[model samples]
Structures are given as structure tokens and as C-alpha cells.
Target: MSAIASSTSPQPSSSPGTTRNTNVTILLACLGVFASYLPVVGVAVALPVIQQALDASTAGLQWVTDAFILPTAALLLTCGMLGELYGRKKVYLAGLTLFCAGSLVCLTAPGIVLVCVGQALAGVGAAALLPSTLALISHVCPDRRKRARAIALWTASLGLGLTLGPVVNGVIVEHLSWRWIFLPSLVIGVMIVVVGMAFLKESRASRDPHLDVPGQLLAIVAITGLVYGVIEGGSAGWASPAVIAAFLVAGAAFVAFVVVELRSPCPMLDMRLFGSRAFSGAAFVMTVTLFAQVGLVFALSEYFGLVHHASTLDIGIRLLALNGFTVLLGPLVGRLMNRTGPGLLLVTGLVISGIGALCVCFFHASTDTGTAALVIAVLGVGIALAMAPITTIAMNSLPRRLAGTAGAANSALRQIGSALGPAVFGAVLTDRTLATLPAHLAESGLNPADQGQVGGVVAHVGIQAGAFLRLDTPTATERALSAYGASFTDALHMCALVSGIGMLVAAAVALVLIGVRNRSPHDATPEPATA
Candidate 1:
């Protein structure tokens, strides 16, 4: 490993001037994260509405979300490197500009294609923002304890964006068009850019090296191919030639990436970083916990809309229980992390969420708001506990100059996990629902003809057959609804089990390798005149 990678990150002196700059930088960084995340759950909740308005196919609808994820995942490392090479503030500003433009495109979009184009633009911007924001925090905060507190706030901001995305969009769609969902993200992004340009400090790697072209290309290919396979496997048959080809491409690209990184003089992502047990453990835990949380949110959102037939606003309100706790408990979690270490908290968070996931199996089509809120609250609190610690763990594992790369690697992995969440859970939902369809339909007392009708549509669109389920055939329709609801709940349980198992695995990883203390030394005098 390069000596720079082993050195502690720059520790800004604790003078009044630098302290003021750090606070502003942290606030701006949090806003940047918040802006990037607004479209995530916000757009998700609006999918059905988009479908109705745009008359989109299932594949097109999937692309609406996937378009945003692909560039964010594919370009994170490159963007991180760019921030490391150039100035982080410059890249961050550029990201905000792109995001603003993308938001504008989506806001005024005339059709589904334009919406996708807009989302892709925003994804690229997010690619720039995610790592730069982290790098900024890692570079600016002089004190480790303060860094922990700042990170806690940063994580809370992320959760707040996610928590409010649905509610904001829901309220928008209640009176306005679905297009208005893009507005909040746009407004916030632009405001951040304007303010940040004046106040945010600049930082970069102390050393410069040639870009690892081969490694970067392979990483893009691997991530894109893997996401494509999982996404297609759910929509297309898993054994289909395209899906299989995508997996093969992803696997091959990943192998090539490993080989290239090992041999490269200046690898885009350092191969040696993974040699540390702490780094590896934190990375793994980050992926699985994200997979569980994002997957749970995706599954439960479907449950509220498809099975419970809740309105968009109603569903968003109910989901507050799932993400709001992160905001409520984030600072406290940070303080606890300082006192108790990240290891105990990370494991406890995972276990609590895991148990809550199991509790999801108890939910049914007839579950009331109160009952659903309680169960979701438990999962939210658990995930909130686990979220901040891993980021700190990953940061502490790496030394100063590699802060941007570490942030990139961490963000990339988490984004990959988030992208996988819906695709994997949706696949499980569709497969399980179809596999158990016959039994439910038979019990519904529907005739052979009606069974074939409901089964065919569900086979084609899975649980998204909300409109088809609303067909008015009196007793037959009612029976079909009941059968579909039962099948959806069964699928929900399967999804919950998958996520719960993932959480347990993460908890185990946390206990073994990721310790509770900061590994990076912070003894150096910090840079002067940051702003």
C-alpha cells in the first residue's frame, strides 16, 4: 500500500477559524446528501402514478428506477477519484448542477423517455456527490469525536431525505401531477450549489497518479452487468439467454477487475484496502444491512399499495415508521458510538432489525395501521442504529489520502446493495406468488376460467396487477382479491426472511472483524484557512 494510504487523514487545527469552516462544511455536505436521496423513494412511490399517466410497460417502469441507479453505481469510483485528483468542491458543485438540470428535465418531461433521461442525468450527478460529500467530511473534521458526530448528522440527513421522499411526492401527487415530485430535489440541489460555492472548502489527495483505465472500465462493466442480470432475471425468465449472458458478463468483468487492480501501479480502488479485516468486515456489513433495509422498504411499500390498497399519501405516512427513527436517534447513536464503540451497536442494530423482519411475517393483508406501524418502527430503529457506525468504521480503517477512495468504495457497495434490493425482493415475490397461486385460487372457489384469468395477468406483471384485481365481477372478484392478498402476504414473508438472514450475516461479520475503536491517528496540525 502507498504510504499515503497508511497516513492519518489531515487533522485541521482546532482554532476558531477552522472550527467555523468545519461546521459550515458539514452542513453543506449533509444538504448534498439530502438532495441526492430525494428522488429515490419519492420516485418509487410515484411509479404507479407514472404508469397510469405515461401508460408505461412493466419493463419501462423498471427502467425508470434502474436508470438512476446504473450511473450512480457505475461512476462512483471515477467520481471519487476525480474529487481526489481535482478539488472536491469543484466536483461537488458540478454534481449539484447536473442534478438540478436533471430535475428540471424530469419536472417538465412530456413522456416516460424524457423522465428516464432526466433520471440518468441525476444519477451521474449523484455519482459525483456521494463520495465528495464523504471526502469533505473526512478531510475537514479535525477531531475524531467531532467527525463521528458529523457523520451521525450526515447519516441522519440521508435517512431524512429517504423518509420524506415518499411523503413529499405523495403530497405533490395528491393535488399536482407526478412531475412535481422532481421539483423538491431540484430546488434543494440548486440552493445547495449556490450556498456551497461561497462557503465549502476544497480538499484533495496529497499525491497524484495516473488513472487506472482498465480497472475503472472493468468495474463499470461488472457493476452494470450484475445489476442488469438481477433486474432482468426478475422480469425476464432467469434462464433466459439475456439474463444468463448478463451474469456471465458481470462475473467475467469482476474477475478481470480483480486481476487488473492487483497488477496496476495506481489502481482506481486499492486492492490492499481489503487486506485489513476491519475494512473488509465493514464493507461486507455495509452491503448486507443496506440490502436488508432497502429491500424491506421496497417490499413493504408494495404490501401497503397492492394488498392494503392504500393511497400514495397513506402509504408514505405509514412508512414513516421505517425511516423516521434514523433522524430521531442518529445523534444519540453517534454519542453512544463514542462511548461504547461501533462493534456492539452495529451488531445490536442488525439483530434488532433482523428480529423485526421476522415480525413482518406476522403481517397480513388485513393488518391495521397501528400494528403495521409498530412492526415497521422496530425495523427502522434497528437499521438506524446500524447505519452510522459502519460509515465511521470504514472511514477509520483507511488513512488520510485514501479518504476519497474509501468513500467511493463504501458508497459504491451500498448503492449496489440498494439496487439489488428491489430486484431480488421483487424476483422472490413474483416467483413465490406464482408458485403458490394455484392453491390460493383453488381455495378462493373461483371457477377454472377465472383462475386462469387472474393467474395469467399475475404471471405477466406479478403484484403490480392492481388494476386487474379491481375488476368488478361481484363474488368472483371479491374471492380473487382475497386469494391475491393471501399470496402477496406469503411473498412478503419470503422477502422478509431473505432480508432477515442477510442482517444476521451482517451482525456476524460485525462481531468478528469490525472493532469499536478509531484506527486512524489524528495528531497532525490541520490545514490553515480552509474557507
Candidate 2:
């Protein structure tokens, strides 16, 4: 192994000037991450407009979103490993360059195919940008206390990006053309490149060179099969041969990944970290909480738009409760983690979130804004509490030298959770809605033709069927809503139950990680910053 792979990240000095520069470096990293994430949410809101304008197919529309996620998820570990082997600064700058190029591709692309290609390019940039920022935080704040605070800020930027992406997209789509979505990202990417060139410093890798190509290839195959199976299985019957094949492929790929990783030198992830109680526990909670929160937000957005007839602006505003508290709570949560341990915060957050999900079970088609807000707000609070400490424990569990890889692993786990949560919940809701269709159609007293119309391969019948079923008779409204209510409630209950399991996993992890003590003053000093 080369010395580059075995070395530790450089430490920044504690001097005031160095501290300021460290903050700047963190800011630049955050900006890059923020810009990368902008496209995910922004493009989603712009999708309908793009489809309308460009005559895109359903598959093309899906690709517009999936293109970003597939590459970002597949290559996260690779980017993290690259940072460890080459240097954080060089890799980070490279990511920014790709991001700029991708944004430009989207801006100038002639059709939907090219747009998907652009998103794929952006995903690569996002993969690199996400883990690098966390690694940089580990390097910049060598002291655990300051590092916790810095991570809090970094996580806050993530929330900001997600929260703002749709709002920005809505503005651009309403006033200008859909292509304008890529314009701002281009400007931001250039800014990140310029700032990185001026301020960022290169860091030495922590270990000798061993690229672990076999492990990486296996991991990619595994994740691709899994994501593909997930998206397709929901539409294709679960019992269908295609779905079964996807699952089988995914399972085989997973087994291959484990075998390859165990044998490879310098594997992308250090699987042994799972042996640390704290690392495993915190990571488990992260995946669960992310699944619950991100999945719920996705479901609710559609509910507001399709069922409640909310406009794009209205949907954005109404959905604010989901992520709004996350930004507000960052600093306070950081200070609280500094005062207390991660165990208390994580457990409390999960419990609160589980309760919030349960509240959605009581929701009706006629649910008022205040009630809706209250339900989402509870989930948001839970998310606010859970996010900070889970990260704290995950990073703090390892020795400083392994922080970069650990951060990458933690992030990959969370993204996996985010991806899975929506897939599972969406499937449940979709299946239950279809199963209840006969009961609803009979109750509506619609003719056979009308019933057929309601039955003909509707998307999200779970959400919109309630309103349409009530349109015929005023007295029928209550009974019609009852059926829809029952179905939606069943879906919510399932989601809550699943999320509760996630919470329990988090709580168990916190308990087992055993000891993470308060930082002493000496350990809180700023360490030298690394790229």
C-alpha cells in the first residue's frame, strides 16, 4: 500500500486566522453541496412543465428524477474512497467542475434524453460533493465539540437545499421557461469552483493505495438491481416473473458485494466499523428516520396536490412544515448535543416522529389546513431532534483517521433509507387503494362505464379517489369519505408501524454504543483543516 492511503487527514491550527479560514472552507463545501442538491427538488417541481413542453413519456419523466439518484447513490462510496486515496481538495474541485458541466448540459440540451444525461452528470457531482463536505468537517474541527457544531451547520445546509429547491423551481417555472432551472445551478457551481480554487487546501490520504475495484463493481451491481427492482416492482405485480427476477438479481449482487468487500484490500467501506456499537446503532437510526421523514414528505406532497387540489405555489407552502423546523432547530440542536449526549436526543426524536406518523392515520379527505400542519409539524420536530445527534454519534464513534470513510458510509446508509422508505410506503398505499376500489365504486352508485373509468389503471387512486367518489350525491359524501378514510388510515398505520420499528432500532443503537462522554476543553481546540 502507498503511504497516501494510510495517512491521516491534516489538522488545522487553533489560531484565529486559521479558524476563520476553516469556516470559509466549510462554507465553500456547503455551497457546493447545496448547489448539487438544488437540482433534485427543483427538477421535480419543474417536471410537469417539462413534460408538457417537451412531450416526454412517463418513463422519460421518471428517468429525469432517477438519473440523479441512481448515480449519486451508486458512486457515493467511490467518491469517499477517492477523497481518502487522492486528496479531498482535488476530488472536491473535480466534483464542482462536473456539476458545472452537468448544469450546462441541462441548460443547452435539445431533448429529454439529453436532460437525463445531464442529471446523471449532476448526480456524479452530487456524489462527490455530499461526502466531501462531511469529511472536510471532520478535518476542520479536530475537536469533537467543534466538530459536532460544524456537522450541525453542514446538515443544516442539506435541509436548506431540500427545502428551497422546490420553491426556487416554482418561481423559475412560473415566470420563465423550464430550462431556466439549470441556469442558477450553473452560476452556483462556478462560484463554488472559484471559491474552492482560492481557499481550499489539500489533505493527505489515511491509507496506502488499494482501489478495491472488485468491491466497488459488486456494490454498484447490488444497488442498481435493488433500486430497479424497487421502482419496477411497485408497478409490476409483486408475483410477476420480472419483479422476482429483479429481486433475485439484487440478492445475488448483494452476496457478491459482501464476498468481494471482505477479500479486497482498501475496500470502499470498512465493514468492521459495524462492530462498534455506536457506529452501527447511530447508522441504523439514521436510515430509519430518513425513511420516515423523506417518505412521508413525498407522500404528503402528492396528497396536497392531487387530492386537495393545491397549486404548485400552494403545495410548496403547505409542505413547508415538513422541513421548515429542521433549519430552525439546527443551532439549538447543536448546542443541546454539546450539553447532553446523543442518546437522549435520538431516542426522543424517534418517539416523537413515530407519534407524528400515527397522527396521519386519523387524516380524512376533509382534513383542514390547521390539522394538516399540526401533523406534519410533529414529524418535522421529530426529524429536527433525530438528525443532529445520529450524525454526532456516527462520526464520533470512530478514531479520527477513519472519519472520512465513516461519514461516507453513514451518508450512503441514509440515502438508502430515503430511497427505500418511499418505495415501500408507496407500494403499500398503491396496493391498498386498488384493493378497496370495488367497495368504493359500488358505494358511489356509478354506472359500469364510470366504474371502468375509475378502474382503468389510475395512478395514486389512493389519494384522489376519495374526492371523486363524493361528487355524485351530497349524502354520499360522508360514506364515500369513510371508505377513502379507512384506506388512507390503513396506509398511515402501516407507515407508522414500519417507522416505529426504525425508531426502536435507533433507540437500541443508542443504548448499545455505551459510552460517548462530554468533550474536555483541550480536545475542543480547532485542529488543522484538511480538504
Give the number of the best model, judged by TM-score.
1
For residues 1-531, write the lDDT of model 2, one tens digit per residue. Answer: 112233464434212238777898778866877787777666888888989988998779878887888788778888888887787787788888888888899888889999999999988987887777777777777777787777777777777777788888888888999999899889988988998888887764566576878777877777777777776765565777877887898799888887666565556665655666666677777877887777777677666665566777677777776667777888887887788766677777777887887787777666899999988889888887878778777777765555566667777777777677667777777767667756766776656665565555344443455545643556544555555555555555566666656665656656556334554322332322222
Q: Largest lDDT belongs to which candidate?
A: 1
**lDDT for position 8 in model 2:** 67
Q: After superposition, how far is residue 389 of candidate 1 from its true place, in Å?
A: 0.4
Write down the worst ten-residue block by lDDT for model 2. 522-531
> Could you tally the backbone clashes for each prediction?
3, 13
> Candidate 2, residue 7: CA error in Å?
4.9
